[model samples]
Target: MEIFKVEKATLSSVDDLKAYHAHIRPFVLQRLEEFRETWERGDEAVFEELVFCILTAGASALMGLRGVEALRPVLWSATAEEIAQRIHFHLYPAARAQYIVAVREVVRNELGGRLKAWIESWRGRDTRRDACVQKFKGIGYKEASHFLRNISFRGYAILDKHILRSLHAFGVIDSDRPPSTRNRYLAIEQRYLTFAHQVGIDPDELDLTLWASRTGMIVK
Candidate 1:
């Protein structure tokens, strides 16, 4: 569990990232803030949010939305094959479908269909993210962070490829490879938080800023 601290940015790319982050900070904050209202809803919406993360694991956010929008009703009852036929994920449809099923199963059996109550029970980043990691299927650190962030929670980083590559471009991380272990993921996340703090950007808005800067679209 020897954590490797990240190197500071030295590339010319750092300036560009700073400029881009500045422009997108307000917009990303707006989007994340919209989720605060979702918490007022119930567990059905919470389950739907979990389904979004499950569908988006190795796919685009748009593809995940497509699956959620197209198969909203069938999500709880459909077989993996059925979901595969309904969505156009273009990557591991059956597997993602199975993941969706697995998520629903876990929420029903483990949480007793009280996903919202269970999630809101945790008061901090460590407890909430760890609870998500322990209870959910098809969700590790990155996915857990993404889900929590989308639900108006702060203090977690989504270490997806776009953010990783942006970090590499700025000479933050060495490579764009996904962190292979929990300790590594959290270590990198801490490094990003440190960098965000140094730059005076809110930690929660950090992912959206990088993502929007790279992809030209700000989304969950």
Candidate 2:
């Protein structure tokens, strides 16, 4: 991790981000530690995190958290229709429900209840992310990166609109528009990584900081 100097900021947004980050740094660090601890809690816990990412497809992070909370009882046991019935808050509840059920079945029957082993077997973060995108129905680049980040992977940019807007505002990226393709996402992700290095923020920490600036909370 390259460290950059954080002298007095010329940009007010950047200055405000730094100020807010300082105030919530400890809390944010704690949340990240919890995310890391999820890996040790076994397959069920890891799958819960994956379900959270699935629920976040077209919904807010808060909604994702709520969906996971709502579905926790039958997440591994419920049918798609049952899952959809429980998903009242998500934008595309039915679609996300189908995705969750299908992915869970694949993990259990085909992968032998070893989702973590399968994920770790992929080698690097990008390769693992790509493998996820290729294997899962509802997972795109953003969702895959989000899942990896929640599971304690570092430096993978979860390029949601809030983070994109921050990058554009700070001139790290040219536009706030979400990337439309794998190549474009990777290109923007590279820009984000470079900006994180230049601004002296860990890419993961900057993700939550920018997200909290918009949503007022630093969640998974």
Candidate 3:
């Protein structure tokens, strides 16, 4: 992750953050609403979201989205080699391909090819995220949170580099270093939540706002 400065002196004020949030709130809500609608698109759409997150590891979100669009034809049946060949513009296509294939097999064989149903079976949001992290080959805490959030599950923080930097800039976190373990991740996520609450912005909205500030785009 790049260590870009956040200009805390200017952007750290909660009032300033709230002003920014007001301007972009509608777009953020629309993106989140689209996430909620993903559940209606059936397992393939949900699985595609997972693939997008998987491809995002060590890659840009736009690159991941482009890769997913390219691989949609054979996403459910492609071999790792096939997937790797199709997944362009990624830093580690082979590794991501293996992960996608492995996770797809697990879902098809063990989870009965009912990805959406299996995810819906979990009672709590955090429980669902934990299950995803444990079961999926390429997923970690951040990716699991990302997948859940993309599927409209609430309260879990993605803690991506942009988020970590934003948290540090806003004084919610002491440093931009990513949490090294699950416990640490949750702790930092709580800190982010607290900061969001204090500033009167929804955590999800604030996350997107921070992400948009860095990327100049708000996307799922």
Candidate 4:
């Protein structure tokens, strides 16, 4: 991890980073393929992944998986307390439950349950993320990007804290603090996307590497 955060860690230019990425390319591709297989399972499977992203906002991706396991069967009808009792996230369980249900309803009503199609129809990741934030009750740009990337979308970058921290460590961004506004978030995301191109890795693939570089795990 110090390879990224330390100023003298060996990578001083995009070409140097590309050489490093080439060394780890096989492992990164393996993890990416794992993510792709999950998305390839069809719409129902993909919606479940979106729920994972929704549950993960302001939380860990690993915890999100557990929360999804606890709430999956009851998400559409369970009481807020019931949903809340199943997980250990920091936020109010009732509000999270409300947002979950509201988002489900919004997705069903607006996109007729075709989340993947809706995402694919957008001309760019930014537009797709904006639409997700507008339509879903609890989804912000990070969650939106997360959902899109989990579904094997090429153009999106999941700017979770792990990713932001790694990017800062690698000098892709100025600081590790979360972006304070939508404009700031987009600007930061653009930096990440540019870095992805420089490394010759897809945004989604680079996202996982950035995360792995920080946490030593190739998580979703």
Lowest lDDT sum, 10 consecutive residues, model 1, at 1-10
For model 3, name the residue pairs that clash. none
Which lDDT values do the candidates have, in the order given?
0.78, 0.84, 0.84, 0.72
Tens digit of per-residue lDDT, candidate 1, span 63-127: 77777887888877888889888875447688887788888888889889988888889987788
What's the ranking of the predictions by TM-score, best on top?
A: 3, 2, 1, 4
The sequence of per-residue lDDT tens digits that candidate 3 reaches over residues 1-220 is 1122222223567777788778777778888888888878888888889999999877778788889888999988789999999985578989999999999998889988899889988998778888999999999999999999988888778899988988898778899998889899989988998888888888888888888777667876
Q: What is the lDDT of residue 9 in candidate 4?
A: 25
Give the residue spans of candidate 4 off by over 4 A. Answer: 1-24, 88-92
Candidate 3 ranges with C-alpha deviation above 4 Å: 1-10
Number of clashes recorded per candidate: 0, 0, 0, 0
Candidates 2 and 3, the one with greater TM-score: 3
Write the residue-wise lDDT of candidate 4 on 152-202 in tens digits.
776776777877777877788899888878999889988988888777777
Structure candidate 4, residue pairs in collision? none
For TM-score, the strongest prediction is 3
Clashes by residue pair, model 1: none
Q: Higher TM-score: candidate 1 or 4?
A: 1
* TM-score for each candidate, following the candidate numbering: 0.87, 0.92, 0.93, 0.82
Q: On a 0 to 100 scale, what is the lDDT of residue 218 in model 3?
A: 82
Stretches of candidate 2 off by over 4 Å are 1-13
